[model samples]
Target: MSASLICELCPKSCRIPEGEAGDCRVRVNVGGKLRATTYGRPSAVHVDPIEKKPLFHFLPGTGTFSIATAGCNLHCKFCQNWELSQRDGTEMEVRYQADPPKVVAGALQTGCRSIAYTYSDPVVFYEYTFDTARLAREKGLKNVLVTAGYITPGPLRRLCKVVDASNTDLKYFDDGAYRRYSDATLKPVLDALVIQKEEGVWLEVTNLVVPTLNDDMEMIRKMCRWMVKHLGPDTPLHFSRFFPMYKLQNLPPTPVETLLRAREEGLAAGLRYVYVGNLHGGAEENTRCPSCGKDAVRRVGFQVLEMGVRDGRCRSCGGKIAGRWGA
Candidate 1:
């Protein structure tokens, strides 16, 4: 029998016996080699506005060709994409057979400026994302990642080479919440975020405010303060409203007021670009100039009404806005 192999991609470091999979369920020990079974076989693919990634600052008003395969490193109880993120390839009924080159071709054919490895944690499909990102970059396209930020340092540093931008789900600031809710730890996610920043990947953060779970005001404030100190004030922070889903269906949806309060806390903590998401019909979705207090990027639910910045600076006050604004 082949020896058991260890999957060192995430903090879990699941050691799988021969012919078995790791904690992520997508990576398998086949012939004693840890291989991604979902590589080149994406379970979901679509064209979405970059804003849907809730990435307001990077390449605003652009369409991203998003793709996701089955499996995720963390098992969040309230996972919005649990159907794709929490399942294995065999259990999934539908999947598309598109290799890295084909994915890049589809993005180019569709006139997308970037390809988002999203809808699931890209970390679970690290090899796939890395290969596709390289191919996409060579094709003059950018790569974005919407992830839970649960990866280890070595793999993350390697992945950052091709990843142009990322929106990492912070989940929670408290270690207990991470452990109890996501079956993960907080420090690795925090470390990954800092590494992404240091490696020059355009970083954005998303905190899904699950009421009664991680919506403590003091904890939120501490998270904001950490961002300012480690990632700087300009790092865009998105407070996404969570609806009861997956394993946590008993909990109520996050209140809009709770989202508002979180946004307020972020801004009060000196973070420049704070946004409220998931719930629609509010001005919190728009980007305002931190200097002049004028609207810099006007939007209505992923549609850009106006671009009030010139060369990445606010046109009203000529203040610098932190994001990738040009092709």
Candidate 2:
């Protein structure tokens, strides 16, 4: 790898010197060319319900083979998975090294319908994700991206080609919120969301309502409004509860009232499917028909307790629900 290897995968655009790594601490200038240090070296792997990704609109009750390497582009103050996402290249204890073909085989062996790139920011490990997604597609396994949507367009389009769905974190509506707390900007995420939607990927957006930082009611309303305007009113929005974690551990857990209020705001903004996450026993977690307000998808924890769709239409009003059901 040469000292002048330019890394433009993400917004950081680090031009690495010899033997140096990018800001994410995963892509290194090895020999001369930029190489992904986490390639085939996964730190975490698990099988989880797609709902665990908090993606209600995408393969709702299906199980997915989820895996991730250790690195992240954002320096979020309230990152729940910071221990893995913020590690240096050598810090991750590689429990297994599975290449794209092995990953596809593993998903098939587990009878997983989809493969999820999750647990950490996939944007930092674009090459690995791209390879695995391509292989997963060839094996007839659906690809899903549980991401922060922080990558540039060129790389994002490449990944989106093989991705069937995505759950992108729209952290905050304000650019200042991102600039101050996450060391990123909001526009790129918004752009990526629009791009993913246009590229025909089933897109779901999540906003973690932190105590004081992004819990502002007005901002939440604005976020919902923007989603409705750009991504359409049928786009599902998830209002997740934020627990105290990492650098922002001083604050208390986000109030249930806050989550409910944000959900209300989203519906008020004309978005059809709005749900609350990271909390149990909430009535708002279930999906309701937009036409007749019928309980279409009954959820208990991550389990699909009951389903009320007949031929993908609501049982009550027969209105079409926006998702791939019984496919």
| Candidate 2 lDDT over residue span 10-64, tens digit each | 8878888888888889898988878888888888889999999977766778889
Models, CA RMSD each: 0.8, 1.2
Error of 2 at 201 (Å): 0.4
Query: Considering only N, C-alpha and C atoms within 3 Å, which residue pairs clash in candidate 1?
Result: none
Candidate 1: what lDDT? 0.93
Candidate 2, which segments miss by more than 4 Å at Cα? none
Which of the numbered candidates is closest to the native, going by highest lDDT?
A: 1
**Model 2 accuracy (lDDT, Cα):** 0.89
* Model number with the top TM-score: 1
lDDT tens readout by residue for model 1, 1-327 = 689888889999898999999999999998988889999999999999999998898889899999999998889999999999889998899989999999999999999999999998899999999999999999999999999999999999999999999999999999999999999999999999999999999999999999899899999999999999999999999999888899999999898999999999999999999999887768998898988898899888888899998899999889988789875
